[model samples]
Target chain A: MQILEFLNTHMDMVYIVILSVLLGVEVISNVPSVLHTPLMSGANAIHGVVIIGAIIIMGKADPSNILTMALGFLAVILGTLNVVGGFVVTDRMLEMFNKKKPGKSKE
Target chain B: MGEYLLEISYLIASVLYILGLKMLSGPKTARKGNLYAAFGMALAILATIFLYVDEEGNKLQNHIWIFGGIAVGSVVGWLAAVRVKMTAMPQMVSIFNGMGGACAALIGLIEFPHYFGHGGSILILLTIFAGLVIGSVSFSGSVVAFAKLNGNMNKDIRLPFYNIINTLFIIAIFAITALLLVGTLTDPMYVYLLALISLAYGVLFVIPIGGADMPVVISLLNSFTGMAAAFGGFLYGNMAMLTGGILVGSAGTILTVVMCNAMNRSLTNVIFGAFGTGGAAVGPGGSGVEKSYKEIGVSDTAVLLNYSQSVVIVPGYGLAVAQAQHVIHELEELLEERGVSVKYAIHPVAGRMPGHMNVLLAESNVEYDKLVEMEDINPEFETTDVVLVVGANDVVNPAAKNDPASPIYGMPILEVEKAKNIIINKRSMNVGYAGIDNELFYHEKNSMLFGDAKSVLVSLVAELKTL
Candidate 1:
């Protein structure tokens, strides 16, 4: 009964999940094969939004409990790495393409 | 008021992410697209830190822990991404994706005790467990993939009856998770035990896969991390995490499917078939015919290149192994100077990951227009004079087309055999990642050029200068 209640109350969130999936598929289908690596990496970076969850948990964590605090702290660190590293690497990859025009003209 | 502001911030961030992904479809706008997504991330983080308020109207207070973690992680992540070689991009992505998975798993672990200690709803419990198990698997699986790509684990190790055992192990994991859900298991240790089992399963799942199947495996794990993050979103009912996570999950899934179609293998076959096992069983075509190949030296290769009207180069992972990208670019330019039109024919599953060959070629300053995908270049091979197969074997393997019994038969290849002169450069007569012999090597028009890719290209460049 509680599970049903929760689902009924959060139907809006469920709709968001479905629409997001459809939109993701539609947008990603247009990417040319040449951009596959950067696109995959960019998507990888986007999922790093779980850092939001990590931050929220850390804030509510009981400071008296070392296990909870430690887990929360570790989550925040790993989440930051995922977000920052994923985006930077993807940008660096695309940067190669950005420079190609100038480099070609110089030749 | 702060709650509404935070919600609005999430909506804007989600829109920017969608726009960022849309712009990624074009090379001209992709760099700015990544910046847009980064800007969105900053907006969301700032909103969370400053605007977030619980029902008790209390703001987040652990400033030192929050900022300190962000500071350390950013410095390390930024340095690693900037300092890594272009050749190492696949493993870098694997490791960073693993970090995301690890973060999700930690959230599950941190939250599980609270729910269990208070007898929370089964729905909440289910989401937490899903995040924990899936996140742990992605984290450990990606670490293994990273190790394999980084050359730390060169050999694919398959235990006896691996598929059956792996199946049983996964079933047991889910069964125990179900038991916990139904209140049959009350111990908190079960949660941690489940995470451990999932981690072990991840390792077992990926350890048997050969190098050639790494693209599918990495894409699958990337999606797994996304699904785990989405579960985190469901747990918190946060729109930003939900949208971002679902987007990644779908993107990774589509990529995995595309790669599987390229290799003509299903996702299940890639995971459980322990592919390349057929390499040892059959020679080319399984006809037991005597196969012989002619060897071409540097000077003759140069002569062939110098006389050709148009040349199409097919590159593979061996090019990366030898760090021959720069030398090959020089060769391309040298050929162009002598009135030979040069283009690179890139197979879809050419290297360790999707579009890996493009990244390697681009890093060496190969013009963007010169890199042609398989669908575009397959027809041109027929009229081309010289087809240079450099550090590549299987992608050009004619067996994929004509040999039905071959493991890679249905896989679309470069069709280099159609060219007037087919010259393949390899270190020796070794089977490629598919573990099968390439029938193209022995074709009438093909000549084997054996040497390290870098030195061989260097010699070819030098020989061209002499001509």
Candidate 2:
């Protein structure tokens, strides 16, 4: 009975949980075609967002709270890292497009 | 009051994700997709912060630690990305995916104890467990993948009793997880140990896989990371997390299937075979069998194909790495204008990734029907007047058929050597990724046009125009 009540009150959280499970299952069970590599790379950029979210959540608190302040700082740092890393990866992928084929004659 | 603002932000973020995905569908728009996705993530992060601040500002007082961690991670990530070469991009990706999984697992660990108290519930517990399992596997599996890609891990490192050891480790992981769930092991130390053991199991799971199978392994690990992220989202009641996680997971799974098809191997064989170990061997006589095969020069190939009834072009990773597909397509077009029937023969696992060759061809607007898989085109090799192998090695190696000592023996390959004449574009008498000499290069029927794939293909196309 207590469990059921807990579930009702936390229905929104439960929805998140269920959705996550479904997503996870989808990720591991299927295969992807070549077209999806760039998509995956793009999605990976979301890691930066996660870092940003973690930062803001921690940052809005009182600076006097040293631990919270530390977490906020960490979030910012990680978020920056995520952003930079994602851009570098995207750049490298783009490099594949820039190369000229070998057969073109040089005057 | 601010709740509405948060909702609106989420909506915008979701739209960005959709647009980003759509843009990513084609090569030309891939850059736009990346930018859109990044922008959406930024929005999502901002909205999440707004909502969380409104709800529980006090609990998030550990901002300092978060910031410090972020700073350290960013510097390291930046340095790694800048230093890594493009050739090693796949390994870098695997490593990053592993890190993401580690982060998700760590988050779950930190929150698991909180849920154990009055505030804790079964739903949270399950989420935590899921995170731990997925994260641990992704972490270790990715490490092994990294090793394989970099050649740090041996491709032939299969243990005699690998299955037995793997079984034992899996059992141990399950048992520990069960104990933790049942409250028989509530200590943080125990949970940490469980994570460690699970990670070890993941490593073991991937180490036995051969280098040829690394692409599939990379895709599988990618999915694992997505699932871990989704679980983390569920634990925290994050909607964007769920959606992004689903997208990655589904995409990864599909890629794995495509890779399996390309290799002409089943997923079961890939997983259970611990691919890359000793398989059927090619015979000693295989190398000598092709001695009667004829060799052709560039001019000879030009002359022969000029009057050929039909021609097939087979491409491999060498073509992609050399960026030669466009030229090959051009050559094909040239042949078509001459009233020659031309088609591309693609061997599954021809390139670094599954469908790699296909993607390259597609990028050049090569006709879809001209792109043929190995199974569909191998039979045509016998009757085909000419087979042009551009920077492809192992896939068209006749040793796979006759050489019992060959590492790739029994692996299905295009019988390009069976054609009336075979012209192979190569740089040297060098072996392929498997590091073994190709006997097909010396066949009397096979002519080696030594040069870069792109350069040779371009010359061929140009030469074809003259003919």
Candidate 3:
């Protein structure tokens, strides 16, 4: 398969992926337990990167095929919603956790 | 040239994502961290659409569909984020997370033909199948979780020999996947069937999970979706996608473990224990005759709180459900105004999600310093004059310590029972979410105040004012 040939040519890139993944997990391990929900939510939004793949497929598909077009359209919509909603909601939730000014009490 | 540009851009985005996650660990810098990560995402998307090229160096051309889809989705997502209440945040998370899974599933659906008919490797197929099964399961399971959390479905359905049925389903899924890999099942029908079966299995995976364990379930499903996306990344050979998915998968798994430890339940038990299923599995603590708890009027509670030198308030899902965070904050203020030092005790798993109670309290503008974690404030309970428990149960239950037979025996609790005098507000004698009777209620120092949390807090605030 042509696919393996293409990937085998880019075998060095796999190291980059492995390093990035390890670093990402290492950093995330430091987050406190309290922020877990928002963390999960924010990560959910990041995986919305699938929309990029969707965009690629939608662009190249035979524009006349109504079924492929519709599926691609739905994919983009759902993916974008996941990304946008995940970030915005996590931000809003985190915003609620601001520290009060030390001297300003009884607000 | 275009490929290099795309990779460099993704590298930049990945660094920003890592930086954002690092900053999120600190409370003061969390909002900034979210912005950084969002900026990273925006960079990845824009760069991909504008620069990435096919083997033939063709870029994406359907500008209208891309922008239109994003715009519509942006509007919908913004409205949902703005309108949702803190108490219902878990529900919103479940629904949105499910969308991510649906995206992965749909991607596999679209690309299946390329893998089957076109030149495709076994590696690609492996990744594709992983995405298909995981995505389908996460999507359907999250829907069930959403329904349960939103109160649309209350029962935890467990058909006869549920474990055997699930095991068989899993076995069949593997067999079918093997057939596909071997080219024995090239028909699109097999993939579609696999998706359908996985989707059905997803529903079953979550239906048996009890209400209290929903948070862990949510985290686990979130990880499932993330792994699916990782497989999607592998399918496309995309670095940014792979990194992001791995980050989510690991983080979600860690959080689920933390939640399990908080409940003192093993991860295995959570998946199979079926704590809230029928029979004696429902509630925690003793199954013996109940002792009558002393009831205190709202006025007495107000007086007790006002006179106390130090007071600790424990809040739970009851506080969230009644939307009483604002009133409770008011009560804290009133007590502090009278020179009574008021503090809050927050359990890790209090309310629906981790740190949710903290968010709820913060929404009412409670000071961060006043909100104490169970580990820190738990010790101070003994020296405190009064411990007011608002809509909390299992977290403060002594049964977790004294009753080895209790399901939650090993879970670390708030130790509110150590305080000099204990006061609790609840609608009635109904057990808490763990469906367990709180032996703390029957303690000699405990005085139960009956009413809705919001109204009761309002009454307590008024009484504090009169004092």
DockQ values per model: 0.77, 0.26, 0.61
Task: Tell me chain A's TM-score in each of the predictions.
Answer: 0.89, 0.53, 0.81
Model 3: docking quality category: medium
lDDT (CA) per prediction: 0.87, 0.67, 0.83
Q: Give stretches of model 1 more than 4 Å off.
A: A1-3, A103-107, B279-289
Give the range of the ten consecutive residues with the poorest summed lDDT in model 2 chain B.
B274-283
TM-score of each: 0.97, 0.73, 0.95
* lDDT, candidate 1, B65-94, per-residue tens: 988889989999999999999889999999
Best by lDDT: 1
Query: For candidate 2, lDDT tens digit of each residue in A1-107?
Result: 86799789978766654654454344333323444444455555554344533454455546686654553454455445545566567555644432222222231
Tell me candidate 2's fraction of native contacts, as a decimal between 0 and 1: 0.27
- What is the Cα-based TM-score of model 1? 0.97
Instruction: Please state the CAPRI-style docking class of candidate 1.
Output: medium
Question: Considering summed lDDT, which 10 consecutive residues are worst modelled in model 3 chain A?
Answer: A98-107
- Which of candidates 1 and 3 is the stronger one according to DockQ? 1
Off by over 4 Å in 3: A1-10, A99-107, B282-290
